[model samples]
Target: MNLSFSKLFFVLAFVFGLFAVMVIAKSVLIPLSMALLVSFILFPVVQKLEAWGVNRLLAAFLSLLMMFLILTGFLTLFSTQIMNFSDQIAGFTGKIMDTLSEVIVYINGNINFIEDLNREELIEEGISWLQASSGTLLQSTFSTTATLFTGIFTTIIFTFLILIYRDGLTKAFVSFGEVENQDRIFRMLQKIQRVGKQYLSGMFILILILGFANSIGLLLIGIDNPFLFGFLAALLSIVPFVGTTIGAVIPVLYAFMSSDSLWVPVAVVIWFWAIQVIESNFLNPKIVGSSLNVNALVAILSLLVGAAVWGVAGMILFLPFASILKVICEEFDQLKPIAMLISNDISGDEKKAAKNSMWIEKVKGWFK
Candidate 1:
């Protein structure tokens, strides 16, 4: 019993130490994590280019350029929508404030929460605060934007370096294992790369499908700028359980503030509720979840742990890391149970179908 307790304490200490290192090195790791995923997505292209006798450096550079152009195009579309949103933001804010005043009045009448409430004074004070903080707000925005670009730049460089030195890295990893296990280690590395590639490709398809589905539903409901809201919501849905709620809430809030009929927001809620059902039951399990093969329990645990450790970036990186972890655990007899626990409990035909994914392969075909 004492031996068991000692072993448990050691395991706990090891886990905590691992997490501490991750938190401390996040600035470097986040970019590297992003690059590792990106490299997997780009690796096939690199291989094809090499097959065509293209120089390795040139191939890596070209792949980065292609990635940059794709990102820039999406950014251009999003920026145009941002401009449109900015134009109407003042009216939207006013409507939201008006709705808040009505709610306050209702609560004051029913609950007698406060003796007197002056919303106008509150608004005036809020505006005064904003006016005073405008310079600080502007500086913060500029800094955030700069950091975003810098992070992107760093990710690109790391990706290029990873691609360039992939051979060396593979050997380094394989060398860590015994001679009898080196071949298995090499294959494990390949599986890790495939997991990253497949997860990302599944995500791209999932987002596109969700964006169009959301936009169509909103258009049917006669919501303004349905595409913008739909796509923005779809983008947020990348974060998992919490993301779905946030994505839906944004549009629901807009409907509440802007539409005259209370029924409009109700209908918006109904649509998103239906979307949540379909996505959780059908789309996600078949698409993204299949790629990760992570059970909901493990996925949620990782999401919470990642959020606690590395914020938004952790949330994004850790799911794939979990998948990679499963791959690693499967190699050890004692650890295979950990892999089993992390994995979805599908078997036979279901497991085979998950392994035989067409999603990422279909996405990859577009590059050719």
Candidate 2:
């Protein structure tokens, strides 16, 4: 009992210690991690340019420039939509408040078990509170926007430098391992980069498909700015489990606030739920593939722990790294079990089938 407890205590201590370090260094680490993952996606572009006889410096510059342009395009689209719709959104305030007041009044009238509730008084209190805090809210929004832009700039700079020195970085990492194990370490790095590249590329394609699908559905439902809202929801889907619901909620709330009929919001909800079903079962597996192969429990745990350690950036970054961690763990006997634990748990028959599979080893050999 004592021995088992001792081992467990040390393991927990190590985990907590890592978390403490992550939290303390998050401001630096978040941008660096973002840059690293992005570089993985961009690495192939850089390589292709060089192979085609482009200057090394020019190749890197062009790759970064392309990335910058793409990102700028997305931001411009979102900002334009938000700017144009801001007034319309404000116009919904009265309608939403009135609807809420009606609901509360109906509840108070019907639910005799509860005391009489003054919906008007409650609405007045809420409006007054908002008025009082408007300045603070504006200040918070400004600060958050500034922080976001600053982080983006830092990540871009880091990504450029990483692309310029990727080879050196790979060598440095390999050198940290024993000479006999150096090749294995290099292979692991390649695997990580491959997984990162494939995952990001797949996510981009999936988002495009989803955005188009959502827009078509929303347009059929007679929603205005369907494309804008569709792409917004699609972008949110990048963050995995929590993001999907949030993506759905914004449009659904807009439907409720803007339409008199409950069915509009209900239709929005049903559409998103159907998208989720199709996305999970068909689109994601086909596009994203099972490269990450993280189990639900581990994926959710990673998101929670990452969010605690590094906020939204952590939530976005950690899942792919968890996949990378599984790769690293697979290189060692002691850690292979952990890799399995992180992976999607399979039934015995499935496991047997995987063990019997020959192509996996063949693919790994090609990399070697």
Name the top lDDT candidate. 1
Task: List model 1 lDDT by residue over 1-368, tens digit each.
Answer: 12356666787999999999999998888898999999999999999999999999999999999988987887787787778767877778666656667777678778888777677865666567768998999999999899888888899999999999999999999999999999999999999999999999999999999999998999999888888889888899889788889999999988877788998899989998998899999999899888899988889998999999989888878888999999998887656657766888656796566643543343333224
> What TM-score, over all chains together, does every model reach?
0.89, 0.88
lDDT: worst 10-residue window of model 1: 358-367
Collision count for each candidate, in order: 0, 0
Q: In model 1, how large is the Cα lDDT of residue 40? A: 99
User: What ranges in model 2 sit over 4 Å off?
Assistant: 1-10, 77-80, 107-123, 345-368
Model 2 TM-score, 2 decimals: 0.88
Q: Output the worst ten-in-a-row residue range by lDDT, candidate 2.
A: 359-368
Local distance difference test, each candidate: 0.86, 0.85
Q: Which digits, one per residue and each the tens of the lDDT, describe model 2 over residues 1-368?
A: 12356656787999989988888988888999999989999999999999999987888899999988997898787786677679788887777677777787787788854576788886897678778999999999999999999999899889989998988999999999999999999999999999999889999998999998888888899787788889889999888788888989988988877777899989999999999999989998778748688888888898998888888888888889899999998887656667767878477786566753543444343323
Give the C-alpha lDDT of model 2.
0.85
